[model samples]
Target chain A: MLKIEGVSKLFNPGTVDEKIALLNANLHMKQGDFVTVIGSNGAGKSTLMNIISGVMKPDAGNIYIEGTEVSQLSEYSRSKWIGRVFQDPMAGTAPRMTIEENLAIAYKRGKPRGFSFGVNSKNRKVFREELSRLGIGLENRMTAKVGLLSGGERQALSLLMATFTRPQILLLDEHTAALDPARAELVTTLTENIVRELNLTTLMVTHNMEQAIRLGNRLIMMDKGKIILQVDEAQKQGLTVERLLGEFERISGKKMADDRVVLG
Target chain B: MLVSLVGAVELGLLYALMALGVYITFRILDFPDLTVDGSFTTGAAIGTVMTIAGSPPWLAVIFAFFGGAVAGTLTGLLHTKGKVNGLLSGIIMMIALYSINLRILGKPNVPLRGEANIFDGASVLTIGLILAVVAKIGLDLFFKTNLGLSLRATGDNSRMIRSFGANTDGTIIMGVALSNALVACSGALIAHSQNAANNSMGIGMIVIGLASVIIGEAIFGAKTIFRATLAVVLGAIIYRVIYALALRVEWLDAQDMKLITAVIIVGALVIPTIRRAIKSKSIAKKRTEEVLSSMGQTSGGGS
Candidate 1:
């Protein structure tokens, strides 16, 4: 359902601080494929996600969602086929807006937004039912500002918002990184349930090795702007953190020194 | 005193339109648009000129709104398309508007020369109240629409809204344009009431608008958009009343009005912080009492 071909991105091409964020990156995913990506700092994990989401265009190749090339599309235009959850809980939802208002916005994603009233009785009922599904009692406070919600609640709401329109692809950039342990677990469970229930084609970037291995049908390791390793579902069944570290050392010729990846 | 109070109410209602415009940019869009200082004058200039040119009063006022909207759109374009900073973009448009307003008026000021204006058919208070209520209701209705939700979201979180497939640039343009349009309308109304449009009439307009919004939100609270807009209107009236009362002092002169305006704004801005501090201190005192009472109960039980 998604194809990325030979994407390259060079930041500050000629300056002293020039860095090749992505080089000839290539990936393809089948429909309903949930893939987890893991990498250390500056491994171009976010750059790849940005390119796929059209937040930043790749300097050299084409990206196709359902066989239609979208490399030239603007971020807002490309968003018709893509849903994203950012790392910061505050980044994925508008704080001052009410829960129902935020959902109304997500419900109309990729659709024409015209003169219709935003939150009518019908949609308000729909939003109430949907919020109840979160099991967080948010339905009772539909008019409450999202800023009043906790980080985990906001992230869960963001996930629901992203999947409400059922985009062609969902990009999650370390979405649970900001929450406390219990909240993170709650969000992680919600993410799994929502992705499974919707059969969504998702690409999740994570710093946690166990989560990287435990979730997703496919796993990929990235380093220095390249996809260094890939493991299918069969291979991932027996994958261990130690083995993954060994593989990283063997291929990149450097120790995996990022404590976040190891400790997380 | 009674006549001054009535005059204050009329002036306050007229400036309420401008205050509402400021509320959109400053409170809703989180944009510090300096364009108000110029666009307010732009409305006055355009409306006054049109009135002098034999157009109907209502038509002239409507034209002034469109004129201000266009000026606001220019600022939005300069900011979004030209990649200029928001403050710089507004400043640039404001400076350009000075020359544009001059061209429209053909001079620094223009007198109506007893030309029939909107207030001629109605009392100033009645007309001002009607127009202000219409603008407020119109704004309230517009904000309930889908486009308005997107605009509010754009101000709250542009990146998130973009990810949801909304064009933030368009929303920004629309918001800034709408804000200035209302401001200019207020300017036109003021010009009609005063019987003249001066180039310097818009000076300190942003400050006054900000003061009204701050005072309104501080006194009345901004629980909802309706309340917020209502508070702004009330704040404008209260501000005018205070100005009128200050003017009654024998030592005060007309030139000191700007200083008074500044002081009023400062006082309004500090009120919230002061309230918070006082509440926190009271809470601390209560907490100490609770702790001491609990300790005394435990000691009595042990004895």
Candidate 2:
């Protein structure tokens, strides 16, 4: 469903504070592949996601989504095939907009927006039904400003929005990291349910090792701008946190130092 | 007093158009566009010049809107394409418009003492009311459209909207252009009603427009776009009424209007913060009472 070839990105090149974000990164995913990504801080995980989403162009790379090369497309253009949920709860939705209005925008994704009214009675009914599916009673608050929603509710709404138009790829960048444990669990469950039901090709970047291991068909570990380890379905079926840590130590020759990863 | 009130309402309605324009850029787009200060003059100058050249008053006003829209587009280009700072781009346009407005008029001012204007046959208040209502209704409808929602979303969160496949840069440009068009239309109407267009007439227009928007939102609330626009119009009228009343003071000169406008804007801006502070303070007091009462109840139960 997605392909990345020879991708490289350098931040502040030629500057004293230069850092290599991505280096010759290569990744591929089959249609409907649910892949979970795990890495420490500065592991180029976000850079990889950003490159795929066209938020920033790789210095040298070709990105193809559903067999179409979109490396040269602008972020908004590339968004036609990509749905993204950001790390910040506040980043995924417009705070001042209402639930139905937000859904209307998501519904128009990858489609031409013209003089037609964004939300009519018909769409409002659809949105209410969809919101009701989340089981959060958000259908009653279709006109409530999204800003008034809790972090968990907003993230869940964002998940619904990302899948509303059924993009070629869905990118989740620590989407539930800001929420409390219970809320995080709710969002994670919602994410799994939505992806599974739609059979969406999804790439979820997570700091939680258990989440990375427990969800998704495959798991990949990234470090120092490269995918250092990948666990296929066979290996992932028996994967454990201690074994993964041992594998990381054996491969990278360094202890897993990220506290969040360790705690998870 | 009655005549002053009537005049205030008339002028208020005229300025309400400009206030709505200001609301688009300031509140909707989250863009601090100073272009209105210049575009207002540009519209007035164009309208007067076109009218002097024997064009119909309505056509002249329409031309004025387009003229201002073009200026606004330039500002948008400077900010978006040229990668200039938004504030700096607006300032550049405002400075450039001074020369453009002077050239258009061929002088510092143009008097329409005997020329045909839209208000020549109609009462100024009636025409102003009609224009204001039309602009409000048009804006309310536009905001309900898909493009309009995208525009509002762009203002609310550019990155988020862009990820939804909306062209944010284009939306910003269109928004800024539309806003200035409205401002220019207001200026054209004012020029016709006042019987003259002066180069200096646009000075401090941004402040007045902002004042109207802030005052309107504070008093009328902005739960919806329609209500927000209505608030802006009412705010403009109230501002004009206050101006007229202030002029009635023996010590205040007509020239002090600008200072009074600044003061009104400051008051409007501060009112919200004051309200918030008072609300928080009352909440804190209520919490203290609750805590003390709970402690007293627990102590009494133990005793």
Q: Candidate 1 local accuracy as lDDT?
A: 0.92
lDDT of residue A44 for candidate 1: 95
The DockQ for candidate 2, computed on C-alphas, is: 0.88
Per-candidate chain B TM: 0.96, 0.97
lDDT of 2: 0.93
For model 2 chain B, give the 10-residue run with minimal summed lDDT: B113-122
Model 1 residue A44 CA deviation in Å: 0.9
Off by over 4 Å in 2: none
Residues B130-168, candidate 2, lDDT per residue (tens digit)?
A: 999999999999998899999999999999999999988
Instruction: List, residue by residue over A1-264, the lDDT tens digit for candidate 2.
Output: 899999999999999989999988888999898999988788999999999998999899899888899998999999999999998989989899899989999999978889999999999988988898898889999999999999999999999998967898999999988899999999999999999988999999998988899999999988889889989888899999889888989998998777666346
Q: Please write out the lDDT profile of model 1 over residues B173-244, one tens digit for every residue.
A: 999999999999999999999999999899899999999999999999998888999999999889899899
Residue pairs in steric clash, candidate 1?
none
The alpha-carbon deviation from the true structure for residue A4 of candidate 2, after best TM-score superposition, in angstroms, is 0.2
Best by DockQ: 2
Docking class of 2: high
